[model samples]
Target: MISKIYSSSSIYFSTDDKIDFFGPKCTREPSYNYKLSGKQDGDGGFWNTFYELDFYIIHNCTNHGAKMRQIRRNTQYAPASALFVEIKPWNSSITNQGQETAEFF
Candidate 1:
């Protein structure tokens, strides 16, 4: 996914720009402890920290993916274009399931 984003025409980055693939620094106790001694804190488990970071990455990816889709459609298809593309009512069913899983996590 990071490679795709980097290679995409819609994405641009400067030399000074830094992309932390995992979103940002983990300042939580579990992450700090795990990194320091390869052990998670008793109260704040590593899995919890991992879940938060995963959520952050997923949220950003979803937003950017939607924006890129919209941009591609705008550039490749005109409003007056008579393209015969089949639309499916269940196209979003998978996305809905993913959202439900994310919420459950």
Candidate 2:
């Protein structure tokens, strides 16, 4: 048997214990759009960005299962780096296994 470990802040967990990727202040409907930010703008932190990367790999299967729809770079006041990845609506075989082979790039 194999086990995988995911590193993320516990504060991002939902009430049901799932990862709260979008977080409490999420401003979009359910989709691949991601807004990763820290406690303050220009805090020079990459915590949420790391989680976004994790979710990207997990959802896209090593970047082979989805296409990037849009990406917004972060600024000092708007420190959240936003991204929207588009995937097939009916891809029932998406292997959410990239976490098992996690790598930081």
Which prediction has the highest TM-score against the true structure? Answer: 2
lDDT at position 48, candidate 1: 23
Pairs of residues clashing in candidate 1: none
User: Model 2 clash pairs?
Assistant: none
Q: How well does candidate 2 match the true structure in TM-score terms?
A: 0.17
lDDT for predicted candidate 1 compared with the true structure: 0.19
Q: Which stretches of candidate 1 lie above 4 Å from their native place?
A: 1-21, 24-38, 43-57, 62-97, 100-105
Count backbone clashes in candidate 2.
0
What TM-score does each of the candidates earn?
A: 0.15, 0.17
